[model samples]
Target: MKYVRKLPATDRQLSNQLIENGWKKIKEPRNFSLAVLFSLPFSYLLGSIILWLAYLLKPTLFEFLISDVLSISFSIDFKMLLYILFVFVYMLIHELIHAVFIPNFTKSKKIFFGLNGLFGFVFTTEPIKKERFLVISIMPFFLLSLVPVFLLNLLGFLNWYTLGLCLINAVGSCVDFLNMFLIAFQVKSGHTIINNGFETYYYPMQNIT
Candidate 1:
């Protein structure tokens, strides 16, 4: 719930404590670029699916995009505004969504968020259960990406502007979605995740108890 100029470095003390308590570190890609590169396939696949489903839900969106987006008649300034706003707003919301889902986020006051270049990140040393951590990871996509598309479609207002935002959010969430899958597959049901800077480690809850 606190904003830091920079995310706290991996808490060696916490890491040692967790290890002493029998926590096992989760192996993650060594760097951000590598992680993003590893997740790009998932990103592309998810992006394609979202675009396809949106097309099915409202075909005219695709029609407008193809016919107008490429045409000189489309207003570049307006589209640019929406793009910029979506990036700015979505960046904050995306990190906030992660922060909100962490158990007793405000009470803990350990959750820290900040921007790294163009990307926003949230991290905490709090040990969150596997299921809970997964929720924190993926909530942003559900709230900001798919929900917007459906809500717009429901209101009969689906258009290229909103559709593009949804797609951008979905693509931007590639790393999170991949992390969800990675943790689910690797970490056991009873495990909990502890963050160390951008790194993550997990261990069985019983070990701490």
Candidate 2:
């Protein structure tokens, strides 16, 4: 594996930390807006898979249970708008989950927070072990999407709002998923990882040609 520094096109606060800490940016910054757009298809794909599993496991219960939820029509009413606002607020909490796990994984409370170009981020300048970084990367998804959605679906209360929140948060987690994918599959196990907004930096733990 060859390592080289690449300048990232981002105005995030973490960029400075990366430079100061002598870590090389391995890739360009991924825009949150672009990530959101790219995640929609995957979100729908996940939804389809869940639905297919439900049908395969329990067709009658699944169809009868979700029928009302599916029948509920979308409307541009005040309540609908309020639900939208709630989802937006929940998104802040989503980013906060990423922040909260930083110290646990890195053993440092020196985390920086910022928002730029439709992205809210929590990052550290310090590099972390690949396993800990993977946990931090996927924590928000488990907290926001997997737990809530699974519980709601299990309790037979999977409404449009719950489903929408799940889908939206799942889509919002595009960057996390991408980072995890790269770390788990693309990057080797010994590399140290630092996430700066959309830019993921890798520090080689072993000599690479």
Candidate 3:
């Protein structure tokens, strides 16, 4: 029971869709810009918090890792071009993470990978459990960002390659974080969440009428 709440739609359009599917939309749809901007501060805070926890868990190891990341010194000849390319590639990886989790969580082959409004996403209309949904949402940050950084430290390789990847992926994950927040705050355990690849809907087990 990590989170429990009624489901919500982002707007009237999604509201109608959810209603058509026999699910209740309990909240308004969030604007694209607002959703992206709202996650910036929280992402930084969460990044800091994770660092602090890492330090507390292993002070010496954390210090070494920090030093390694900080010691990475190099200049890119085509920084802007590289940044742009990396973003597209990393975003693909991010969406792929979501897509990969679909089969595990849903019995449907209706998964989709595409852009919606101002963002790119992997969407599905399949019903998924709360815990599994969270895992699907958070997997990219863990595999693409966290795991790479951890491995960099463990392998005694200190460079900007993995560090940059982590940072880029972290920033790119703002939307996922927002969705995770909404789901965690609004949805209860044991309930199924349905997504039409854009908005998510939920119905209470005891009150589906």
Superposition error at 38 for model 2 (Å): 5.9
Off by over 4 Å in 3: 1-17, 20-22, 26-29, 49-84, 104-109, 115-119, 205-209
TM-score of each: 0.87, 0.66, 0.69
Predicted candidate 1 versus true structure: per-residue lDDT over 1-209, tens digit per residue? 77777667776787788778787777788667888998998799778977987888988766756674575464668768778877788788888988888877888777788887777888787778888888888888888888888898999878877787778888988999778888998899878787786578887775421
Residue 140, candidate 2: how far off, in angstroms? 1.9
TM-score of 1: 0.87
Q: Give the Å shift of residue 153 in candidate 1.
A: 0.7
Clashes of 1: 0
- The prediction achieving the highest lDDT against the true structure is 1
Score each candidate by Cα lDDT: 0.80, 0.64, 0.65
Which residue pairs collide, candidate 2? none
Q: Candidate 1: misplaced stretches above 4 Å?
A: 64-79, 206-209
Q: What is the model-wide C-alpha lDDT for candidate 2?
A: 0.64
Q: Rank the candidates by lDDT, best first.
A: 1, 3, 2
* Residue 194 lDDT (model 3): 74
